[model samples]
Target: MGKNLLFIALIILSGCKGISQEEKKEDKDTKEIAYAVSKTDAEWRAELTDMEYYVLRKAATENAFTSDLLDNKEKGTYVCAACATPLFRSENKFKSGTGWPSFDKEIEGNVAYDVDYKIGYPRTEEHCATCGGHLGHVFNDGPRETTGKRHCINGVALDFIPDSK
Candidate 1:
């Protein structure tokens, strides 16, 4: 009975993987998790630009102040570049001076959350619910007048849609 129990414990432990959200390159043996709009890695690479693929699929951060949409003040919506899932509204966007597009809130139910320790500290990682594309991280230091949650997003992971005139 003792040997049997030891074998069972070893089997269980062997099947478990670290929960940290590492880049796909680090764990090429694992399968991608399912999402509402899943696609093959080749399809994603063919669809997105190099930068977009890095930010959305590989979970990389873009350089600060490098996004064209950082200063966008027009009324519109921001959708996931990978899957076109609405993620944030223009009204929620604010100039946090973080050099990337910042928002106080997300379009409810359109975003998903996961905890990642890729930076040596646990941070709330956000993704597009439809395609599971990495959007960015959320912080607590935000305007107290509104949601008080600062969603620091990667501009390359999102596309803007101006309100129809």
Candidate 2:
């Protein structure tokens, strides 16, 4: 009788051990938890030009007066550089006179806000929620009727598409 009881306990423990192992295997097969674009750094460098890399990865700001899209009147979507996700639309863009690509709003729920202490004053900075790439900064001082916000984006983080006539 004692031998039978010990054997039963061993069987139960083995079954539990198998289940745990299976769960771990499933977890290993799953994707990473972070919201980063799937492409590697090398892939991004290959896709974008040198200037684009300077702004997107190195956080280098482009000249506001030189960006061709600041006064652009065309309609199209703005996509992410690292992941190519649709972020902003032409409709949201406006001339904020701040020398950056200004957007009155984002593409709804895609913008994630974080405290940017880079300047040492805790300003609000935005990033791609899908790939965790930096986009630009947000300010409360904007058009009073429209979204009550200003999304000052770096032109390097975006690829503009012109609308078809």
Candidate 3:
């Protein structure tokens, strides 16, 4: 009976081992995909501000209605703070009232999407295609008159460039 119990425990442990191995394989696969503006951890830490590093590098969220960009109405382009990649244009900006800066569309190929399970469910996470900096999440609840997609972005992850007249 003791031998049988030990065999059963070993089988259960082996079954669990495959899950972590598969997860590690998936993580490695993701890391293999190169970005345009890659940087070492020290470089990124030195370049970005505290909030910017937290949101862009660590995928942290800012408080609602706390971003100055949320109320911005000027014509400009929003670029990635880490890589200066043009992400969203002023024309695409909208009032989603979710407190973060909301955009209806993104400059194509500037943003990448990944499935994030941080909130206990799968959310479409947006990142800068150039630097792989975390931008925010995209949702389906947007203006019906447009693409019906909301690119909910973190203000700290972006840098706004006003169009020169």
**How does each model score on TM-score?**
0.81, 0.71, 0.82
Find the number of clashing residue pairs for candidate 2: 3
RMSD of 1: 8.8
Task: Name the best candidate (by TM-score).
Answer: 3
TM-score of model 1 (CA atoms)? 0.81
User: Deviation in angstroms for 152 in model 1?
Assistant: 0.2
Give residue 99's lDDT in candidate 3 (0 to 100). 97
lDDT values for all models: 0.91, 0.75, 0.89
Error of 3 at 119 (Å): 1.7
Per-residue lDDT of candidate 3, residues 34-140 (tens digit): 88898987999999999999899889998989888999999999999998999999999999999999999999999998887656556899999998899999999
| Candidate 3 lowest-lDDT run of ten | 20-29
Candidate 2 or 3, higher TM-score? 3
Better of 1 and 3 by TM-score: 3
List, residue by residue over 25-142, the lDDT tens digit for candidate 2: 2221144546656566797678778877777765667777677667777899887776777788998888899988899889876767676555535568777777666788899977
Off by over 4 Å in 3: 1-30
Instruction: Show where candidate 1 strays beyond 4 Å.
Output: 1-32
Residue 143 in model 2: lDDT: 79
RMSD to true structure for each model, in Å = 8.8, 14.3, 5.6
